[model samples]
Target chain A: MVRPAMSKEGQRPDPESDADHRAFANAAWSIPSYLLSGMAVYGGLGWLLDRWLGTSALLPIGVVVGLALALYLVYHRYGR
Target chain B: MSARQLLAAEGGNEFQAPGTEIFEWGPLWHGAPSWLTKPTLIVALSVIIVCGFFWAAFSKPKLVPRGVQNVGEVGYLFVRDQLARPLIGKDGDKWMPFLMSTFFFILVMNLMGVVPVMQLPAPSHIAFAIVPAAVVYVLMIFLSIKEQGLVGYFRNMMFPPGLPAWLYVILSPIELLSNIILRPFTHAVRLFANMFAGHLIIAFFATVAYWFLFEKLTPLGASLGLLGFVMTIIMTAFEIFVQALQAFIFTLLAASYIGGALHPDH
Candidate 1:
């Protein structure tokens, strides 16, 4: 395996750290899509339910709940 | 007659801000195909320019780079190091041809918004943006299914490890929709929206400057016209930065998507 060059301090850069950094960026970029999808899915479901049940509040509730769930997903996946 | 002359002739007319109408280009000539509009022509020109540039740069390899080849190498190194290597890992070099072409093609197309004759970025048309993004999306799906079996790809995407099985019922739908549908949608929209908005804003400022300074020149409006003129210059400079940045971001995200598909565990 060809190793990366050493730092001035004579310490080799850890390859895993680079991969971790990339994973971090990827997670950050994907978070918005996840949040939007979460809202769309649950909100659509809630809107359907509201039409069937003749209620108007479920849509807002679904959106808020979906947003919270998406945040939780982000935290669970990326926050260690 | 030129737009300026037409507007100037209409004395005392109100300032008309450039609108979505500015983006609507008819065919280059009467009786021409509707699809043969300015943007389509610019896209074709951009393709030729990108191909011609690389051909000139690399047609004859030099032991030591000089002139266009030097510039080409710099571009290659920037994409490889900044985008491909960082995002796609060790396999980055292998995918250079695809990623490099994507980066340059987009950069050149986005830059057309600033070029004098071709003031329209091709990707602003949405269809241009969609085509490249769709290609990447299809490639991503193909790679994911090929590397990880079709079932494995979906399992890994929808049911990420470390999540409890019961929770998967709710969260899985989000993951599936995001990865399968929203990812490419957002990817294409990001580039299209940026280019569309940037070009519109610059046109708005330029129109303001032209309308006030020439057509409706008055003491009160003169200052505003000066302000518009200054803003036009500033925004054009900023638009150049934004164009390059959007191109970089589009490529970066493409690489990230490919990286995810190729190495799902990451």
Candidate 2:
């Protein structure tokens, strides 16, 4: 929840708070970036593996690995 | 009761059409319904709900939060402190609201299936999931490229710091392709497929359960009905977990994408 305006005579929020909110919004760019990167990497691997192994399973395999890696990082961070 | 009569009772939860696919939207008229079928509608509605809820909470901001604001803070704080902050470190606070909104949006869309009137899971539709998945893809790639430079990012992602020459040759392409091409597609597909399959599972069991309980026209119907009823309940729980799990996975991956982008070497 947002804190009420701190001014006794109705002053504005500290510039820092506005800056902080702006920063949070900007961080959203990563959603598109990593997702694209991961897909490109994983899709390519799937294709390569499919060619080498003669199976369609490589794509799913790559997915499982990617998901695991992502989850691993989350767990590692929160584990603290 | 006859199977026809059993299924004809549309008001009941157990009712199902004989040949219809459960939850299948099969060609809406000539195409699909404009409001419900369009991916934009789903995404827009999700945003509205989340923003509206939060705005309501903060409309009259409070020093000591209460009710909805309190619940909202708990969710936001979890994302900010737990997921985003640690992953992005000091700069993490910047991404909290984005991550928070994304998590709730995806979670609600995923859970739509279990909600009685909203029988369809919006994320089950690839078009809806693809947008966010694509967003994550671009974010990760840009971070890597920005931090490591194109060549450096490629090297960092494809070739690890220490590996034997022979392994390098093998692992290089695998890692390159995996990190570059496949991640976003699968990320989208995973959510889409899970929701799709989930809807189907609910449909299948629901139809069978209904038939067993009411339509078979035999004493054995009662026994089959019990089995189906129990299964329906169990599957409902399973579906709920899957919905939540997919949301967590989506958000976690989104955060990790930022994490990897910020620290490609790690």
Candidate 3:
């Protein structure tokens, strides 16, 4: 299912490869965890920053940045 | 038993909620038998059942399969085709025994919850699920370290091959947190939560049925009891599918972890 998303590059298409299926399964399970961990680590950092600096805005900002980072990480590794 | 008594004690006025006391247990007997608890017994029974089934099936290899072998072959094929081959891809055979035992043991353990006269699922008790998750985590760590030297494993895991160097500082923590900490936690909790909630629902309905129909019998109450009884039956069937599925997923993830350790994405 994910194979069709491969963009038009010079790369040879091996849609039926075992490695492709394995990588697909790995990514399927993995992406959610990446998002969660990104949220957790950055959100915690943001909370700490709020506590230390007496500012309330960092928490939401941190979560957004964390989410973008996580999405970018997934794209760099799997989607691209 | 206590729910009925408590309701009766209330002069049959209001329905008393079934409490968490349902999970509590005293040892089966005094002295050395103190170790004999429902969860403990269920786990042991599940282990024996798994081993016994496989032993019977493959005790003597026949040219043409018989009863036990036929059942065994079906299970073996399921683990191989569905889990090992698709998830692990190459060098998957070596992990078959671990995956096979894990799938069957968990399946049997989960099924025990629905079985009459022994309705407690062992894995629902978080500890049962944690042990396997820990073992798989240890195996994953070990395999990764062994296959790719210690520093290399850590490098590959945290810093995926082609990412810019500066991003590693920001992202390595995410990778570490996800792989090292969260993976095992989720691995154990997924199976545990599913079984726990399934058992809780089944128990709740069963208690309702027993409490309303047998103890406090009334036309209105009997209808609720019948609903409870019907839900109990339906949930039990649903629980069977859930049980098998959870087992399959647990095993599949285990294989995926090992495979990832063996061959990281280049």
**How high is each candidate's interface RMSD, in Å?**
5.4, 10.6, 9.4
Q: Give the runs in model 3 whose Cα sits over 4 Å from its true position.
A: A1-16, B1-12, B30-33
lDDT of 3 by residue, B1-266 (tens): 34555466556556655565666666855654776888899999999999998889888857577788878877877787677766776567678899999989999999998888788888888999999999999999999999998999999999887877899999999899999999999899999999988888888888788877887789889999999899989999999999989998899889899889988863
Q: Tell me the tens digit of each residue's lDDT in model 3 across A1-80.
A: 11222213213235357688788888888888899899988988999999999999999988888888888888888897
What value does the lDDT take at residue B119 in candidate 1?
84
TM-score of each: 0.94, 0.70, 0.90
Model 2: CA > 4 A from native? A1-80, B1-20, B26-43
Best by lDDT: 1
**Candidate maximizing TM-score:** 1
Error of 1 at B195 (Å): 0.6
Evaluate residue A33 in candidate 3 and report its C-alpha lDDT on the 0 to 100 scale: 86
Clashing pairs in 1: none
Ranking by lDDT: 1, 3, 2
Off by over 4 Å in 1: A1-14, B1-12
